[model samples]
Target: MLKKDSLLKGTIILAAAALVVRFLGLFQRIPLDYMLGSIGQAAFNSANTIYLLLLTIATGGIPLSISKMISTRYALGRPDEAKRIYQAALMFGAVTGLLLATAMFVLAPVYERLSRVPDSAVSLQAIAPALLLFPIIAMMRGYFQGRQIMAAGGISQIMEQILRLIGGIGLAFIVLGLGWGDKYGAAAVAFGSVLGSIGAFSVMMWFARKLKKQDRDEESAIATDKAAKPSSKLPFRTIYREIFRTSIAAVVTAMTVQFVYFFDQSFFMRLTSVFYNHDTAIKVLAEYTNRAMGIAGIPPILAIALGASIIPVISSAYALKNMEEVQRQSSLVMRIVFFTGVPVALLLTVASYSVTGLLFKSPSGYDTVALLTAGAIFQITMMISNSILYGLNKPKQPMYHTFIGLGLKVVCSLALAPFLGVYGLIIGSSICFIVITLLNVRTINKEINLNILGNKWFAYLAAIAVPALAGWGTEYLVLNLTDAWANKVSYFIAAAVTSVIVGGLYLIMLAALRVITPEDVRSFPGPLRKVLTLVLKPFYKRAA
Candidate 1:
């Protein structure tokens, strides 16, 4: 069984890796945005939404299902059964991948009509092949996670994103240089999705093989001891049934955000058309939703990686019926996620214009970006909460709440769009996740006396206030200081200075308030822990 210490370490590793991958993705998107402009980005995003939907459906919750099953069995001292379960899951994944890829490739034309973006058809076809490869990658990562070996998954993710950045941007520039127009350039970038999946799958397959060999060697070492009483495996049908049961709930919970975003893709242009011409509406919607989403996407990486790392650990604890451990870990994860999320959301909101201008070479959608970044607090909280629910075998609760949130999003967007324009859609996204997160938090309180709003919560709020105020001051100073400089230079200076000041103040405030202790420092990676330890030890001495 994986220890809580190992789980914490694993979460740090995954979170750090996720940060790197997100940075790479940010780099890729910045250049890609410059190349595609708002309209091409609109087409690309629309096609990408379809791909994400199919990808989510095709894999569903299979990875988490596999992880939960394996961890449960492994916790019960049934290694052989866990191995058999993984083998069967691999088969299921392969077939699902094949069918989903074929379906997407063949139905590209129909999807084009549905999305109302003709250029999306080419992008859709380019991204179709990835559906065939990613399921296997996900399954292997899940297996390693169940084994509490997070580095393999982290490594594979980094490798996948590296290849994606190189291949996608390289091809995009190649196409653009050849004078092929943004349509072809976007398609070329989409084709890189397949390459990225292939790279990740290859890396995961290598690790899976390595793990299999290690497992075999360990089994050989214990062969004599196990020979007397070998455990029997579950019936294939029974295993499949359990997998599907878990998967359906997981899929619903996991796909909530994607489905909501897909709703935006499907209706954004049409709804905006009520205010402007069709082409103009498309461009406006693209600027508001697509660009804003891209900028907003980066901050959730750490929460997502931590949530992913927590699932199998939490599942294993639940399988052992350790309610205390479950409660402790769940509360801790939520606190950590919230602590990271609050300042990020605040800083992003405060420096939205600078950040948008620096990264996208324009400040056109800064308001939307600011709103979405603030909404990320809800989004990140909901992600971690959803994982905890899944770990507790309460997946249906989150799934139901997500539907409520999605319904609210649709209704709010429809009612507010005509008057408020694209900002209405941003409102929908924010309110949807905030309501969903609150519901999830209430459920968690009942499940495990989390004390989410106790004195510690006040400390967290106080800690956040320091950085929020400092961030605004720094942004103002830098922007005013760089007024004589070029636009990009001014934005870069403001964003960079504000980021440093905000980050430093946030950490210091946490340390001073005693909200972050030595134990928390140990949860970070070695280098970070060292730096934090240095900053925190004086406080520790005073507290003692």
Candidate 2:
């Protein structure tokens, strides 16, 4: 029903690139955390998250909608239509990006007050320029994806993240060396986003040139038929209408992950003000944003990659009305995300103390880190399922579900933050994701009679429970055993050792439980499959 190995290969490429960027972010935080301290890191995160929320709003829906629409057209043998759609998307992206960038720059002070993080307004203003370029880059990436081309996008992502990291680190060092306070240092780091966007734009423009050449070649080949048809006269207004129809729902669905964080960013301080003093509220929100949000955010990168990759594939299938194929891909992706996401989340939660200690000089946010990381499982599932819903052409389901879940999140956080502090916000987020994930899966099942977990729900719970208990035990033992501790080098050894032992044990249990069976392993792309086979050899063998 589907092309050979496209989904596997595309997902693996995107996943690998996303993995590098995500982990690089952790390593990037090390020096930054030292330079900024918790308060400064808070400033960094406050500006970063505010910038990201607007970035999502500007680029999120357009790119995804392009991918979906273009893929649907191509599946119907309308390559000319697909090309026209991309052109329209490009113009739209440029205009939208300029507007959003201007809005961000003009409203930086408003965001600073809302987030209640001191020294954030300058950083927010500094990061706005990045918004001007990235929307175009994102749309181009989506076009490549619509064409089922993955390399250009993946390479450009690496380029963007690498330059961003280098620029941020370099600028922050210069600011701090000049004896500027954290205020300017944070702004300097935030300005690096503009540098990163330029790098990404360069890579994307190069790819765009090649893509245009290919498009011309395609046009010449099809000039006698498709391109000459009356259908090719489709108007610009129709393009805008179609894009907006999908994009409005798409934007809300895309915000599912960040919407909760935006709530915390905007209201956490204001809500908890009566219960805690200004300094105390700021400290708690800082830890919540910097440490908790940082560690918790890692594993979901894979899900996001897989989710995005699924769009074109799912759109093609949905275009054909092949619900069975949609069902197959949906079930496979859900299991893959959960099976992969659970262990990593549990490890981070169990090892949050060591991880935070390694990254931060004075680690005081381990509890928040643990809470957030523990929630990543649900976060990962919710994301993949959201993608699945989008593929089903039920784009509005995730949008509505996100708002409903946010309502609950807002209520739970407000009602409890007074009593429980940061944990209240985190617990509220966890509940939100869990509810949304379940709702999404239920909707998918209703639409396609999807298979979710089947008889393996307990198997999954055991897979989660066993590794968590063991990893927690191992962490406690190591922390208690190591008195020569708290230094970065010492924490590094503890983290490395714990990761190896826990990771090995977790894989063994997964194999023994048959969480990933031989049939499932075969669906993986060749390189990943080979590596996984070798890793799982002692516990489970692969078919030759």
lDDT of each: 0.80, 0.80
Largest lDDT belongs to which candidate?
Answer: 2
TM-score of each: 0.86, 0.88
Task: Please state every model's RMSD to the true fold in angstroms.
Answer: 4.2, 4.0
**Whole-model alpha-carbon lDDT for candidate 2:** 0.80
After the best TM-score superposition of candidate 1, give how far the Cα of residue 70 lies from its true spot, in angstroms: 3.4
lDDT of 1 by residue, 63-167 (tens): 767877888888998887898888887787788889888887888788777767657778877888888888877888778878878887788889888888789
| Backbone clashes under 3 angstroms, per model | 0, 0
Stretches of model 1 off by over 4 angstroms after superposition: 1-9, 71-83, 212-235, 309-329, 453-477, 500-544
